[model samples]
Target chain A: MSGHNVVAEAFAQTQYQVGGHGKRIVQVLKDVLNEVEGTVEGDMYGSGKLIADFEAKMAEYLGKESAVFFPSGTMAQQIALRIWCDELGLKKVAYHPLSHLEIHEEAGLRELHGIESVLLGEKDRLIQLEEILNLQEEIACLLLELPQREIGGQLPSFEDLQKISAHCREKGIRLHLDGARLFEILPYYQKTAQEVCALFDSVYVSFYKGIGGIAGAILAGSAEFTKQSKVWKRRHGGDLISLYPYILTADAYFDQRIPKMGQYYEQAQELAGLYNQCPRVTTWPEVPVSNMFHVHVELPKAELEPILAAVYAETGVGLTPYVREYDESTSSFEVGIGDRYAQVPKDALHTAFRLLHEKLQNL
Target chain B: MSGHNVVAEAFAQTQYQVGGHGKRIVQVLKDVLNEVEGTVEGDMYGSGKLIADFEAKMAEYLGKESAVFFPSGTMAQQIALRIWCDELGLKKVAYHPLSHLEIHEEAGLRELHGIESVLLGEKDRLIQLEEILNLQEEIACLLLELPQREIGGQLPSFEDLQKISAHCREKGIRLHLDGARLFEILPYYQKTAQEVCALFDSVYVSFYKGIGGIAGAILAGSAEFTKQSKVWKRRHGGDLISLYPYILTADAYFDQRIPKMGQYYEQAQELAGLYNQCPRVTTWPEVPVSNMFHVHVELPKAELEPILAAVYAETGVGLTPYVREYDESTSSFEVGIGDRYAQVPKDALHTAFRLLHEKLQNL
Candidate 1:
């Protein structure tokens, strides 16, 4: 038995652990690990000054007139759509069916916010102008997720986005960007943050995603919109005293990691190309335009698990699709790049495939 | 110049340096530092496993079968009420008129959740059976914040709470406890955590406030309740991967600090006695029953700021109500026992009063 088997077997004993995933609990950090020593005092309601400073920096970063920090992007986006619907007296906001607001958010937009979402576009494709034109006039806004995640990290073309933006503006409907993965989208578009943000009335960004913070989000928009969001933020218990820790982390990553996104983007293309060459693997949408892409593997769902587990057990390399079994004959995986291994070497990919193939053969 | 003036002036010029309160910013943590880490990585979604574990522990601690974590107690409580309203097929949640949900949340209960809040308590007291006897059938749940925060940290008598719980049971309405400051309420009730938690179907607790984690919340209830909450949490974007940091922090605090509440309760009583002796400061409800109480001072609003600033400047003490003017003639402030200053001595209380009195006399 290898190191991973020992851990996996141990984790298998717990109700929460599944198939060796969500295992390896992260260590609790105590003591000052960063360059700053935070005050140990508890003041979560946040002072007025801290709120003002966080909003200012967020606005400046996204090139919006103002911003409000939220505990979750779901709340921020839901509130944004709710406010949009209220402002226009429209009943719905339109978006791709697989958008996080739709599939993942447990119908919060409908249940919590009371704003109905018009699911446009094909079930698995990115939203397009054809979908928009077919929508009824009651839509107060159209929410567009850059580099849509659910459809294997697919993105709409820049021309299509511009056309959609102009269409919404012409029709007197608001355009909101669910820019949770905006950082990943920027390199693909070769656009400045301001240029992309300028395309929407409001943009929602997460600090913890690519930026690597503990937990936080910024909802950037016009000063008026942000002020209204601040009220909602407080109401939602999103406000905290001395958001300085999250702010500091965001600042650190903004300077150190953000500039390197273009390199990561370039590397993603290289990685996708390597996976595409594997006989049993089919990469989504051909080329990688963003830092994320999904791969579909034609492998027996039951057979693939043990072999892949053995491979990870032998080598410290973990392959994703991390067991997203689509059916008995098919399974898929999504890859996210961070400050970890990027542009996986061809030999490693081959070795991984060999291990996977042998495992299926044994089965 | 006084030390505080010089430090405050320096901070003003330096844009208020981070990590200056408890210890110096060091590359390596020198002391134990109470196990709070200086930095966090990954988005809370992928990196917040600590949050999930914390929620589970919170559920166990509250004697609930399951739990979900949130960014803010305000959001957690609001969403809980909203969930109750939807599940029960009603549209109202009864709470105190001065509930944090109403005043502090910026009408979010109304604006975001679309669930109307029926204020049940008197303007200055906890809700009794009389307040809710007239409640219409539309009421879905009643929100009870043990030791209600806004009204000078007053609590309903234990028997009163039992009656209220019975009333909700009889009416077939759910009971949700906004137990944000619940740690302070336990000693007064002389009840164990399980005993108090038994009265409500759901409870919300804060990590940063009582537990001293960076930021997080736990909403606990039945297994079914938590399963539904997970969907609601994901919709609200609260689901994160590695919450180990918060979970560890909360766990460590629960182990090391929770057992010490009895001491804090005693010290709080001592501080209340000291404040009662101060002629210039009149405490609300005569004395504090728990770790928190309010002080009313007959001071001009503008004059109070400088005096409080001077006190904090002279000694690193943060006193609040520092100036909330009730009318033109009277002002009020709230005091809570924190880790840094567990108890405010009688002499220290006199010193703060004497300094304020001198400043007011001069004015």
Candidate 2:
């Protein structure tokens, strides 16, 4: 197997996964399956009370008028943009260069929907209000990802977000929130999910990322938008004969995890502080805006991989295995503090870091 | 509630369902879940041994070099055409006007992929080879749906299919089989799945339609085609965190139902004979090409609905609840013989049709 697979296998065998692990995930699914009543079976193509209930609940939580469950955030967001552009008769959208739609989706928004994305904002930073004002082209929508993932879970100030939202409204440009991690960032913004979601005309949230569901997403907006999205969902082949597993798990996890965001945020802060204390380690942004941040270890990935593996082998504490090499001498990796992180005592995390530091020092 | 919803509710309460019922579906899922072992947890987004094993098995069964599981057939078939068109630098494909891509998918093949579909055949009939030959535009692919659904599960003869396939091959056109009910049609062809599938460049098969899985599809083709499809799958948001439920169910059902397709086909033939015996009813084609055929009742849908409901209320045999209005005085509905149909005896079906004929005569 490849090195990544080897590390993944090692991580899987470990007792505690920094994020959700396999056994725990299966148990959660089983528990949710058992608890799901009345609508044990969903519609043939995602059009029944089970999915409707989940969508309604999500919309209510996010303070949107309606919501539609999607099998993936990628499809949800792509269709959202497509609908916006089609309605406005404009083919252009603007977003951060590192947006999931721009980078991770293989340019589907362009290749599939003929959506031309105008990249705004500097690398590793939130899009500034000035950047939106500088755009010359007629654009249908602006996609904003809360706690921008590629840049170590960073977020702009609430005031900055308001300014951008206001500008988009004034220009009659629809704003779409790629809020895959919206739930996780709310504590940092000290805003209700509604307050954050209110700024966007449409919002897409992932059930698996912060909510700990097996897999699913909810795109929330006006009932009209959701109706159109349902048609798009079917076109995209996302309308499964049944979505009970995803719905039940998302429902259970939403209730379980939404309230725990503050704890995860706190844990992230503690982890960041510990990493900052180390001489050779530094966190991008120095403090995380959400429950995730990137840690840059001055050691190269070639050296860092063995150290991480050794740490897991010797201490049975599995830290992140994959590290993106910045250059020949340095590497960085994202650390996401989830429920699994809470299971490990803070001191053990400290000890793991200390061992990692010592191993780097020896190298 | 709408009239359709009311009818659906009544159908749900009945003991005998024309298709797989909710209770039985849940039981099958539970049984499959219990049978799954080793890698109970799949890859983060459909990249583990469990999914791989299922894909390999499907590919081998279909006589393709490779296969990839998708969350839905809409996405699978769309991606297949997209890849074919992109590789050939052609933007057009042809299919029967009533193909699922034309009617059901909200024009995603065009709206999303910029693929212009040339509707090749008349409604409710197989796409004739002559029609393909007369097409003026240079087309990249030809999508053939086995047992045309909207027209009554009709299929061209095996000789006709081979002729079409040979013509396409000579013209450098890619043939894609939208074989959603491929297993069902195999008995009529008197050919193996491999023999039928070999004619197509790529084939998309639904696990749920005839195989009785909850929901999923496998796109089988050459290894290179599947490799590109994986990228498209990710772009389309088909790469779920885990597909264990779908994989397990599809695997189990493929084994359970594939061998029994011949039996279902025979039963459908027997059922069609009984329907033809009814004075006020006629089976489309007079004989089914597969395990499904259309039953056209001389009575209007409005007049027939109550009679069917009354019959179900009096006897436990539940006939179809909804019927397509063929005209002001005629209506038709499809009869799909599945595992559920196997549960009902031939005499009961005959009695139900006889009663329907009596009721229509009285009206």
| Candidate with the greatest TM-score versus the true structure | 2
Instruction: Report the backbone clash tally of model 1.
Output: 24
Candidate 2, residue A138: lDDT: 87
Tens-digit per-residue lDDT, B85-123, candidate 2: 999999999888989998889888887788999988788
Which tens-of-lDDT digit does each residue in A69-186 have in candidate 1? 7766877888788778878998688888888887777787887667887878886577777878667657899999887888777888888888888888989889999887888779
Query: TM-score, chain A, per candidate?
Result: 0.85, 0.93
Model 2 lDDT per residue over A17-94, tens place: 564322423455666665544335555576766777888888899999999888889999999998999899999999
What does candidate 1's lDDT look like per residue over B1-363, in tens digits? Answer: 233443244323321121111211221122323444334332345334445556666777788888876656776787788778889998888888888887777887787667887878687776776676667646899998877778778887888788888888998899999887787678778887779989999998876554555556788888887777667667655564344444554566566667666666676676666556655567765667666777776765555556666755554344552357666877676666655344444455556556655655565
**Model 2, residue A124: what's the lDDT?**
65
Error of 2 at B316 (Å): 2.2
The DockQ assigned to candidate 2 is 0.53
The best candidate by DockQ is 2
lDDT value, candidate 1, whole model: 0.67
